[model samples]
Target: MNELQNFDFEGNEVRTVLINGEPYFVGKDVATAIGYQNTRKAIKDHVKTKYMREERIVTPSGTQTMTVISEPGIYQLAGQSKLPTADPFQDWIYEEVLPSIRKHGAYLTDEKIEEALLNPDTIISLATQLKNEREGRLIAEQQVKEFQPKVSYYDKVLSNDALMTISLIAKDYGMSGAGMNKLLHELGVQYRQGGTWLLYAKYQRTGWTHSETKMVPRKDGTEKAVLNTKWTQKGRLGLYELLKTNGYLPLIEMKDESAV
Candidate 1:
């Protein structure tokens, strides 16, 4: 049996155990810490079977069987919680509890420290391992930071389900709508027809552009319905690649000439 460790969260006790070197939390404790009134029900509803298991835990009374959930199960439960303490609970677990468990091996005992201190070689080896691990983590973090802007921009674009007008896409490239239309025409991507811009025959069936009818005021102050073309996210992505291939880039992707 693995050693059972306890952590305090908002005055509640969350018990954890390491199974195969990975931390797993007691389901009841986690549900209570996150303000779930019905712990069993919450765990059943939110956490999947794969992330939870039955474990035998020893208490002051006797050994008892209880449900324990893995780290992913904790996140799954936390994501569905609407309580005010949910975010703080998750933050505490990830930023403090997890790091402490990983670094100190669930909780270091005085006996364990004394054994390590007795061996000079063990201490030196541990120091080297920790140093190498920290260096690797730092390098990975730096790479993630460097790519974060591009990732965020792509995420924003993909998450937006609403269609974009030519003006909106043009604004991203630091060009006016008319300028963008003219550029697309010159590139053979689109053509003007009946006062509306449309994708070429080859591109028409690609689901890139959608046509919507909008009422506009004419010179005689009469309202006339016109077909307005909008671009889908996929279309925008296609256009981005096409423009980049032709030596054009969105303002966000353009590098500073002065810095170069």
Candidate 2:
């Protein structure tokens, strides 16, 4: 995961992460800052799955999974909001956060550019660099346009939702869902009942997990709705801390340490 960067928007903190060189805003942070009462519902209803991603973010509490949205997703949420601060929030993002992220460094002011233009040697060097960069950007843009349709289709398919199942979460720890469930049970995080894993009583109503009803095909070719529990980003983060405290680390973290 990329390092988390925080930006202030009128006293609200918006966290962002970079994935594959593209910036993504933390969904809950953006939604809350935009004055949404129900942040999760707002994001789910307004943001497309293709524009959202689940990533583990390291915070003061611990490493936790969170949903991050792309720039377009940010616009979509801001555009739909009816709050008074919506317009100002959009302006802040466009005029500050986005430009900062894209530049990834200090930007030259117009006066600085003009000064550089006066120096013949600097002008030649800058012109050559700009020409090469423009050419590279053009080629990349052309390739993206050519493959955009297919890429869009696949992105939609692969990113169906931001929620993650126990099985999916277990993969990070190189364990099966059953194995992870058993471990959590032993660690007093959850308990299995009625062939389903449920959080312990103390952890209930804490937004750590969400129960979703999924349709399961029966042997008779019929389908039945089954209540399935999935880990929320918050839950994933909690789990990371719990597991880490017990001396278990995710595969990625292990790999990072090994490399160091």
Candidate 3:
């Protein structure tokens, strides 16, 4: 910058000059005091500047290009190179990304780095993930972080006819559909065309008090029902039989003869 300033100006007159496209204030008196000039001369003392110089540096970490520009007492450290070659980010690459890339390509070496960087998928994915993460645009749950504290109700209560259905279940070993139906009827459990109690038992309940059994797949990946049986409801078998015969399982039921 000082070299450019020296190269472009030569005069005894303190000519008004522009730096960085703006006029820089310098007095004819102060100009002489600053050893710039004495009288005002527009031509010979004029100092103009343009795009200056650039450098390509290969550091222990990586390679980067920088640019230089001439301004008042100011200078530009980079020109067209958009990537930063300074600390923080630079250190991260040298200490973090480079190792991963080196391992991916085999070892921490330039050749390995070149090959890893050349891979289109890896480069694009890394760039995109970095951008998204910086902007909080990535879907954190995509890989299932499970960070949120899992919340679930644990205590379970058996319904009035639920145990009755389970009883039918045990009798049939889960096959005797008729005894199931009859027991359902005696219990006033509602049903008609299709038996839903046993199926219901094997599945889950969301709105009512939790079922006695939690529905989960076992280690073999096959789901099985396990009973909790903490609380039980005294069932009305009269209503149970009526509903079982008709397959009318209401939210509430009555076992009284008249109600049936």
Candidate 4:
């Protein structure tokens, strides 16, 4: 840091006030002040308020004078920064959002829980997800230890080779074709719907397709029922609730090239 010093500018309209080793604008009054102390305070006040706090300042003027920046007014700036921090959003997320998702996550899919945890995404959201994931795993592990797994009607249908045809189930389990369809509908299965599989980005559901069921017809004329569910995001994080809690699907490696 440059210190206040006595200097003569050889009587010019423009003059330099050298502090420690830097030049600070001292206003014409302080630049032509009677002594070093006055010149020093003018420069010190400027350094404290402006360049030092706003950013690092460098001067290439003559003399080895360089002042270590000591700006107290910078405290006001320290209170505000460009980089996102967790301070502001901490209260709502930790107290409200995260806990709410954790409570409701079982009914929700992993994707939806993640969405709630990510809504109004702030640093707190990131922290919540990072930490909540660990707690979530622990919570899930405990839930699994207590879990009672059961197969859905779809699973029962899929597992049957002799009754691969929906028509066969309608003949046997179903009272009528429509009654069988009603049973399937009650259990959330689709018979003949077809459309594009991938939803568009920025979809209304925060990048997730509404949980849906579709029945595809195989070449053998019997419908091969498929549960069309996947997370919109690559990690399939949204579906973790379903995967971990309900035990609907087999565990597979969750891909994360971004972490690499």
Better of 2 and 4 by lDDT: 2
The global C-alpha lDDT for each of the candidates, from Candidate 1 onward, is 0.79, 0.76, 0.32, 0.36
**Rank by lDDT, descending?**
1, 2, 4, 3
Better of 1 and 2 by TM-score: 1
Cα lDDT tens digits, model 1, 1-260, are 66688999979999998665457899999999999999999999878898899988776667888899977677777766768887798789878887887676333346646766898876666566556556644664454343433444455577798999999998878999999999999999999888999889989998888998999999999999999889999888888778877977677655432233
Q: What is the C-alpha RMSD of each candidate to the true structure, in Å?
A: 8.7, 16.3, 30.7, 26.1
Ranking by TM-score: 1, 2, 3, 4
Tell me the lDDT of candidate 2.
0.76
- Among all windows of ten consecutive residues in candidate 4, which has the lowest summed lDDT? 71-80
lDDT for position 63 in model 1: 84
Each candidate structure's TM-score, on Cα atoms with residue i matched to residue i, is: 0.44, 0.42, 0.16, 0.16
Error of 1 at 158 (Å): 24
Candidate 1 lDDT for residue 230: 94
Pairs with backbone N, CA or C atoms under 3 Å apart (clashes), candidate 1? none
Tell me which residue pairs clash in candidate 2: 64-237
Candidate 2: residue 153 lDDT (0-100): 32
Give the lowest summed-lDDT range of ten residues in model 2. 148-157
**162-201 per-residue lDDT for model 2 (tens digits):** 6788898899789998999999999999987787898988
